[model samples]
Target: MNRFLQQPIWRFYDQSISMKYNSPLESFATDDTLCQLVGQLQSPPTIRTWVHDAAVVLGIQDHRLPYVQQGMKVLEARGYHPIVRNSGGLAVALDTGVLNISIVLSEQAEALSIDAGYDVMVALVKALFPEAADKIEAYEIVGSYCPGSYDLSIQGKKFAGISQRRLRQGVAVQIYLCIEGSGAKRAALIRDFYEVSLQGEETKFAYPQIVPSVMASLSELVDASLTVDTVVIRLQQILHDLAHEVHMEPFHDEELTLYSFYLQRVLQRNAKMLEPK
Candidate 1:
């Protein structure tokens, strides 16, 4: 299956400007908008990059924990807005120091497998940093928030996690790359979130017992001063090199309208889950 799938098969569309919303909520809303566009074939497959000021995106499982509300309170007190995401994975940290990218592709292209989607993003990362790419490996990275087989790590320290959102016939493979700042501190935030949400109570599902030291930002892991902006630029360079022609444009007004619908749906989903019994 690996050899049969062509390299660089996905069409690349880049959004020109960063989203208007400084909050993660708005960023997520934009992702849904793009997802719908790609799903409907109204837009080409895209590789969009975005940054949120400071936010903690909680997974659906994280919301089910008995004391998630209290965990959110801690996030709020620390000046980070918390919002639940419509994807897999546990809680993850996002901020100006982080770079979030989504690769929206057609599922019909070639029987898109879950691992294939993950590898596409992994391949992109490897191309971007060839020097450190060899050191980049995928594993559970135990003790890391959102532990998964595709967790992107270097020397045992995880710097990024991947998730997917599939719509009608389109697949959006997403990853949050921690480019700068203290990776351990972000992990600590999630560690504390679990502590608050679980309060040491055991549950049917085993949540990761987070060890902050296991996660480090790309800058820390590579021993180079890297910023989100720098990483974004590198991404652009790679896209240009790979694509026949790359255009940076903003979402059309019509696309924004679709996003409005998806955003409302996301809000309603969260509302229904939070409703009192």
Candidate 2:
């Protein structure tokens, strides 16, 4: 158990239930805005929920693949706009069916560590589904896309993947929960992506050979129809129970300015790296 997980803070905000935009651009903008707010200590320990239309978010390493164009094309043909993210992990699918949650806090105050950040996300998921909480486990589901040591799963089927980003003194631990739709279909897309990108070339970075059966949406795993909104509401209930008060507020103007600067920097970096060199 990490110390950060046990630390009791005076201020915490559960902004996780807010209905956000469905556009990828808007979601990216919100993430940048929240990161800036956290960096400036203008916000409380914040939890945010977001969802975007069909989009394939690629990790930095995924962009380095020899034939990434083919992978992008495949995603585009399947109604997903492939964009490389300024974060760790390989390709991940995001659609209306998926709900993304971010927990942002000050590293100095939280005494945050890498594993601590992941544990926070794991704890939040367990809180969200108490009935299945004990059944949930965190481990690298071998054949899952964006496979990681902290992958959130139940009965060997992965439902979420976690990643982190730090800006200034703030650390944002993010997770994408597959709330609905066919998780296997999403995995199949990434499986095809890896095949197209690698094209039989032996690479040192061993991308997972995806087994679609090992992944499933929360709806499937819970045996009930679920949606992002339902998960979002549950996340709020959990956070509110844990916090003094959860404020529903938008980003301030200064935070938006900082986000603009950071967003441009991230986009520029992506463009330069993605461009044919």
Candidate 3:
């Protein structure tokens, strides 16, 4: 068990239910704000869960695609909004069935190594679904979108991807769990995006060659009927069991001001990234 997971108290916020902060832009901004709050010792370690309707979040490297605009059009045709994220990693698909979790912890006392942060998320996900503990593995799924060292997979099929952000002495370890629907179908979207964007041109960064079959939803992997709501309940239960207390403490008014600042910065950066080249 990771020491970070056993914090004395954790602040819990569930935005997936209300769908109020469902946009990828707002979600990223909120994470940044939480990073600042937690890093400054204004808030305790926080766990946030969220979901977006239909989005394809591109990475910093993704913006360099030769035909990127046309690639975004493909996603838009399928009712998915495409936007670049302020994090490291390639493109990833997000829909109503996907659940996003962020474990924000302060580094005031001790800083977490990059791998340590990822390990904590892996441990939590394993704890969340104990039945699949033996099957779950953390290794890069070659044909999966956003392939990384910490890609969560069953057998050779990936169901989740984790990324991290460090700001203001805080570390936010975030993961998007494909809980329902077709993970391969989502992978197909990214495959198409890359094929169109790359146009067989070589680039400095080696964007993934996504194989749709290499990805599967958690429900698909475990052979169980798992939904976003049920996963949220399970996560809450796990938090309560791990920590002495879990509080549903949302942002204070002052925190809202920080959120707004981050929101604008994210918005501005996204707009700038997508500008005509």
Best candidate, TM-score-wise? 3
As a TM-score, model 2 comes out at 0.90
Worst window of 10 by summed lDDT in candidate 2: 1-10
Off by over 4 Å in 3: none
Residue-level lDDT for 17 in candidate 2: 39
Per-residue alpha-carbon lDDT of candidate 3 for residues 1-277, written as tens digits (9 for 90 to 100): 7788999999998998675336699999999999999999999999999999889999999999999999999999999999899889999999988999999999999989999999999999999999999999999899899999999999999999999999999999999999999999999999999999999998988999889999999999995688999999999999999899999988889999999999999999999999978
Tens-digit lDDT string for candidate 1 (132-165): 9899999899999999999999989999999998
Report clash pairs, candidate 2. none
lDDT of 3: 0.93
- Weakest ten-residue segment in model 1 by summed lDDT: 1-10
> In terms of TM-score, which candidate is stronger, 2 or 3?
3
Candidate 2 residue 249 Cα shift, in angstroms, is 0.9
Provide backbone clash counts, one per model: 0, 0, 0
TM-score of 1: 0.91
What are the lDDT figures for the candidates, one per model? 0.79, 0.78, 0.93
Task: Give the Å shift of residue 55 in candidate 3.
Answer: 0.4
| lDDT of model 1 at position 189 | 91
Q: Which scores greater on TM-score, model 1 or model 3?
A: 3
